[model samples]
Target chain A: MREQGRGDRLTALLRRGPLLAVLVLYTLYTTLPFLWVGAMSLRTTAEISADHYGLPSPAHWGKFRAAWVDSNFAGYFWNSTVVVVSAVAIVTVLGAMAAHALARYRFPGNRLIYFVLFSSIIFPPQIVLLSLFQILVNYDLYNTRTGLVLVYVSLQLPLTVFILEAFFARIPQDLFEAARIDGYTDFQIFLRIVVPVGMPAIVTTVILNFVHLWNEYLFAVVLVSDEDLRTLPVGIQRFMGDYFQDIGMIATGVMIAVIPVIVVYAFFSEKLIQGMTAGAVK
Target chain B: MSAPADAARLPAAAAPRRWWPAARRGERDPGAPSWLTLMAFLAPALLLYAGLTAYPVVRTFADSLYDLENMDAPRFVGLAHFVAIWSDETFLRAIRNTLVWSFVAPFLDVATGLLLALCLYAGVPFARFLRIAWFTPVLLSYVVVSILWLWIYNYDWGALNLALRALGLDGWARAWLGESSTALAALMVTHAWKWAGFNMVVCLAALHALPSEVLEAAELDHCGWAAKLRHIIIPMMRPTLLNLYILAFIGKMKVFDLVWIMTQGGPMWSTETVSTYVYKRAFAWNTFDLGYPSAIAVVWFIIVLAAAAVLHLAFRQREKLEY
Candidate 1:
């Protein structure tokens, strides 16, 4: 019996050994492209496709500066920043309010409204891009920051509300009852108490929305015609033409888009994981 | 300092009213103030949603019904554009390409991700470092990943070909993205490389939540590794696995950036997806059969809706198991 038990233990270890090795190897494989991109960003155009796969010798740091200035990436970066910030702010506020009302009040058409909003989360943006471009053209908001911000806010509202509602429902109702008895109005209670308590969810919503709006290419490419109005994703696409190539600059543009998200994730990874898992275990 | 104590003191020794309009509690009536507060929070979002998202979706269907670009006047085309797209060869090809994309990519990604997650979760050394490394690609913009992969797929100077030749597999080092048969497959693999970490992280989270006792029991029973996983681990992880599968399916159907960057429906439109085909028709081809792509979009929307509904029903019926 003891011999059989030992054999089983040995077999288990053997089975797990390859899996552990393969997983670590695959993880390195996954990070390789990102490291390559960052390396390319620092390499000159000439050495980008050269024999060296690891590092560039002279370390051409000017590509980042060149990509920033020569490509007018500064303007694109600012454009993305404004649109994303405004969209995230609006979505966070509106979504919180909608979630509060949905979770707290018993109103007619409440379930129906919830269902509609939830369904909207699944609606693909491609279905509406054509009409959206036309409408923006008609309203004279086409190619403008305000137009892009508006589109982003509308697109993200459903998801914001969905996650926020789930978070709100978990907050104890006794807190609300006590606030009401303290002579605080419903609006005040939500603004003062609920909002403060729900800061983590709001932060997660902001970071995710920020990442999304920064990297949005489809709308920026299609709706905006003027070069000055381009966002980073669209701006980077300009590097690729029929044949003439500059891989380093393109990689630099990608790095610019990437750094912000990495920084935010580094600071707020806990909130991101909470938002993603949505208290699944809890 | 002592904020919780102060808040705790506020509600005691008061007769709780069943219902109080603002004045019954110690505060002044916030009649107009409350309304303004609600509107303040709601107006910007409502205006944006109504004007941009909701209006555009409605207008897409409306635009599909009209022929508006003619010099003379706009005419009602009804569903002719939609009908025409059914027979449109490029549209058909795009549909076929998207079908392959949605079906194949998601399965491969989910399978690889699950395997990787199981491996990483085995209490291996440097496991946390491996987790971070694997998740790195998901942080980059799709444009960057696409660009890098494009270079990697180059015929002569690409790293992939170079590596193949170094391994003495010179005959196998063909232009991966140049051929019609392999172009879509290459793009799929690139996407899998980018997103597999995301799925792995998700699955790993679920794995981390499982109870240790079940595995211990299997071990005590002298069950070998395969039986333990099949009988204990896999059955326990069904719900999370299902959710990831559906999410992957929906995501793959909307695959755009990688395909656009790598091939651009290239060689001869062999790699075209519904999204690229839609863009081409609306902007590139300029036939303004806006209805055709809209119909395709509508179909895509319906598939998503159906999938969500099925998933919802499944979740409702699933018995909750304790960790």
Candidate 2:
């Protein structure tokens, strides 16, 4: 009761006032650009340029249609989905297998392999741009969506293994022993026990790898040169120069590109946050 | 890239082991698979990783030694490419720009994160909504972030200038991505905006895991909030903070897309990072000779490794908090 006295209450308010204000401001800072873009997408370019920063009165659906059909954003969307899905599927399996080996075994070079994979996270992917370009061209995999998928798989495998292996290592050893008595092979154990038990982590990896490879641009830009094969980010950038003044159209394009990833995050925000901060936390 | 297990940092011999990837303790046993089975599990990932990452690392270093500029069979020039870039004025400028970013961006990002984390930990209103809203930017592609900010930074009708003019700070308005002076710092602001939420999540986790008994004791002893943060919370979360700082540092060092999309390292190469420089040299410079870019990358690579090692060493020997 004494703590709630008017003088004490005022002091408490004074102590917390600035922090509350700052938090609100920062929330706006983070959310405003998104709001601005969404608002811009629904309004006309003339209205936007004239500084009529009101609500999207008389919202228009024309830009979305134009972006999808005429701007070839539909093509970019399909290409991104195919590349990301294929890469995520491949990397999940390969990464799960590698993580399974590293977690469940005591081979001679076990730690060696783990560190080698783990350390690649620090190597800037740009360092590989030149050599990988030469390799892809030499192998005739250049400018192909399948080729882009391979590069995405390799680029994303390190983080996938990092998260999954940690999750897998904590699986109780008794599961394997029980399976062994039942005459299950290692591969079968992986399929029946590890895969089933590790689904949360596997799903976490799938969500993370999907988000990562979906937005992957540098490799896709370098590896795929054909217009039809270009991913969403690259395709958007190429066409962005053409409609440089069409702010509403540009906003519409941004919405089309980001809305799906945002939907995915809306469903699994916890896992996305966890996977992004994979090594920093427990 | 490695966050050593907190338990791994507890003992006295925690120096080198702290750099090792976190793995299980005492998990090995009769359950260990044979080498053949192990390879069966590991081969596909390793082979792909080797071809794309490991092989390229070695090949980049090797190609840097040759004169591969003209598409002829390689000529082994042996260190000349490295020597050449060191003397090249624009390359040196790129290094300076990158180093400057490596320091400034991470500090801004982590500082913003620390502020947000503290607020969230203190149970700020609508904390769940705030956290989600804050992190939405992290999910955006660089192309999207870049274009959105480009519009905002436009000279005539961008929101920033509009707001500044509304506030009657009319003289403060200028082309953000156009200036040679403010260009790099402006881009760094976007980088912070996009990534500070990530650091916030990490710091929030660290904060949540701190021993509440110690905080209760601090309250019992009537420690001021500022004093408590300074003398207790920060000291306890030192490792996580350092981890975030290092990660952000390395990220800015390797940054490319923001610069490429926003400015193309323009306004006289003001925002040119090592990554964009290497890209332009190898691809856009029309030399078609990757050797020079490879050399630049190798040098920057070594610089990055050295910076990481030094940071790791400087933050070494922090007493593992046991509260």
Candidate 3:
């Protein structure tokens, strides 16, 4: 029995050897750049230039402070927070309302509305870029935070509704029926019952949308050319362009942008995965 | 409770009364809410979607037929911009590059994702930790990702070249993003890195959804790993693979951020794509001709729709295997 067990162990090792190696290599490939960035952010530009791959010696933690103060990341960060928060809040409430109606109500143009909204997923935003710009300008909303918020909400509405629809459908109809029997109106039942039950879906959409809107660059770049209105992504792009030579400062700026997302992912990685893959997998 | 008198008193309300709770009436569940209530529920979303998304899309189609400049009235110029795009060198280059990206990026991403998912499915050591680590990039914004890779791909003091020089292979290292020959490929590598993990998570989910008994059956049949993968696992994974492929294809076709931040279609327009070119024509360039960019967008949209339709039909023809 002992001899056979030893032999089995050897065979298993041989079987898993190449697979293990590939996994390790791939993990390193994905992670090493992040590590390098962290290390580079702590070192001076001269130190980085001297030994690009070396770890920071006596890490210059002040680089982040400098990046925040000098590069205007703080202002950009504030703008991103405001825009993402407002957009996500509106998207969640509005998306839930629409999703609830679609999932529960049988009305005229229901299927048509759902199909129209769903099909819009395949239409990339670039298709509407020219006209969207024109419309935003004509509405006297160009270069305004409110304009960006409106665009962000509209852009994310489809996915938010899509995710919420699935979750809302899974909700037990009996609860709503029971509420209705208790003299609760549709609006009241939706506000009181549907919103509470749909919290998980709402949270998922919020995190996902937050990540997307916060990172949104294309629209932010095109629609808002004013420096005061720049979001984090655009701000960082411009910072990188100006400070191309200052690798440490650039890395510091990137870390500021990246850390929140990493923290969110760490806390809610499963929800994040489920939310993102919900459309494709289904 | 007097039916004849009530019906006579409210003849116009008869249809609505019957349709109000349509499900209990032995017909379709027209849902429980009244039309007015349902419309109230839908109004906020409908207004936003229509005013912003739907209207703009329709307007883009209309705008493509006009010759409009900044603050200028749109003059009808039916298909002129579209015809001119075919002869425009930069636009043609963008189209070519976009086509290349659409084909190459998806294949690489899906292929890499499948490999990683298969490894995880086979059960490697610390599989949970490795899965999370692999998925780290998916959480990062493209701007951060671009910055990370920018440092790595920097000509001097970048990790990539520094590592190459340290390995005594200095000849292989060059300005990765600056050269026309390598710019597109370099940009694609960044895209693949960011997205492969996302695809892996998707594929892993699909794999987990697969029945293990069938895999065991194949093993019991003395099928080798390769043979089992070919005859059993792959066939079962067809629907998922097709879905991932289509998603990846569409994503790549519309990809803008990485290229815009990393290369900006530079080094003589080597990495120009439909998305970037549309932006350039409409905004970045001083031309300010909305009509031309609208033309590009309309054409690109049609191509995307056609491609999606073809893929859908192609994938649909194959019989899905039921477990």
Candidate 4:
């Protein structure tokens, strides 16, 4: 009987073995494109074309350097940085203030304001694409970094305000009353009290807004026509148009665009995940 | 700054009892503040959002009435552009593609996400590691993700073809993104890859928050995996699924980057979505007909609104489930 039980256990193990192997294989299949891109980036066009199935040679090492210059990646990198950082900073400060008020205070039209912000999420971006472009051109803000920053801030404000408001609303009310008793002005209370307690939420908002702004392509493409003002996405288009056959360099350029996002994720992966998923679960 | 003082100056009785009855019961209401406090916090965001988002949206409607490129005296061509789009093959194709893109991609992505969440929830070995690995694609910009996949789908020396050849299935390999028939679907699959992690993360959070006892009870009742998921888990996850569906729908409708990167809505405009088609009309094709694009955009907006309304009504009666 013991031998029979052992045989049954062996069969179970055998059944599970293939399932486990398949899962591992599926995971690899999912990630193969990423790994392949990295490998292809390191290979020269000749190396990629010559073997068709062989490993990349050492001759492709300079492709990254060539992509950097040929793609005008430095300009793209700078433009993206300027627009994203500035938009994140501005939205963070403004969003915090709005969130604090909406959460803590009772005022006429407060519900109306909340609905306005919330409903902004429903406005399809394409609807505003033409008009925003026209308005920016009329103001002579089109094709400028400031114009892109404004669009980013507008695009990002609703989400940031929504998340931050939810966070600020959770702060213990006694803390505010205590600060009030201590004669701390509202600004002082916000600056010294709410800001400190809300650092986690703020950080999350900053990371999210940064990612959104950095990845923005529509506004960048529509508004900025000059090659000099192009952000990373637009810059990549220029690179692709200019070097349609240089797959190695185009891959290298793409890999460069992906690095910052990965680095940011590595540092704030936890908070970013929590913040994003929080809305869905609730 | 002076607003708080002004608020304080109001007669004490008029200000109402500021003491919290909830505090006496060891519960606190966080929304206890004077009007001044509210203004100090809320005004800045309202102003910015109004200036940037609300204003531009209203302006879009107004701009649709005029022909800006012609510098023609701001003539109002009410509904003419809308009428014209019905005859425009590009616009019609874009509408069809956008509908397919939004509906199909979201369904696949959400379903994939739900499956992944279930796998992780079952405590599959290396589950945590799988979560991180799957999420790497989400971190990549659409620019990079599209480029990487385009190579993998390349005809001659592509990864997919290479894999097929390795498995002695060379006859099955094809130019995934090059052909018009498969290009849209290929793009949709790439989109699913990029966002499946996002939806999975969302669903996983909800799944984790579900009452474990309920699941256990279902299991004890001889409920198999499929039955338990269908009867217990999915019913509980209805609201989340609806919200994510709306979000995914809107996102797919407005998709540009991956399509732009992979095929540029090309190979004879086969995959030209509404947003991309509008973009082409206004910019690439330089049609000088802003009204037409705006009309298409307005229709897109209406479809999104319809989706949101339907979802909202469907989920309206659900009990708020807290994590």
- The candidate that achieves the highest lDDT relative to the unseen native structure: 2
lDDT of each: 0.71, 0.83, 0.82, 0.75
Please write out the lDDT profile of model 1 over residues A1-282, one tens digit for every residue.
999999999998797777766865686677666777788888877786565375867788887898788788898898888878888888888888887766565545556666667667667668778888777787898888888887788888877776666556555566766677889877788888767766666666776676667777888788887889888877777656522477677778778878877777677665554444342222
Could you tell me which 10 consecutive residues in candidate 4 chain B have the lowest summed lDDT? B13-22
Off by over 4 Å in 1: A1-17, A49-54, A242-244, A273-282, B1-44, B70-72, B307-323
Prediction 1 TM-score vs. true: 0.87
lDDT of 2 by residue, B10-100 (tens): 2211111233376446785465567788888999998898888888889899999988876559888998997888788888889999999
Candidate 4 residues B146-238, lDDT tens each? Answer: 777887898888877888998999898999887898988889888998888888887887799799999999989999988999999998887
**Candidate topping DockQ:** 2
Better of 2 and 3 by TM-score: 2
The candidate maximizing TM-score is 2
Per-model TM-score versus the true fold: 0.87, 0.93, 0.92, 0.89
Q: How would you class the docking of model 4?
A: acceptable
lDDT rank order: 2, 3, 4, 1
The sequence of per-residue lDDT tens digits that candidate 2 reaches over residues A92-155 is 9999999888888887888888887877777877678789988888888988887788888998
What lDDT score goes with residue B67 in model 2? 81
Model with the higher lDDT, candidate 2 or 4: 2
Q: Over the stretch B1-323, how does candidate 3's per-residue lDDT look in tens digits?
A: 13223222321111111100122222223345676887788999999999999899899999899988845677899989989989999988998998898877888998899889999999777888888889888878888998888878988877789889999999999999999999999999999999998889878877898898998888789999889878887888887787788878888888898888888889899999989899888888889778889999999999888887787767766643343
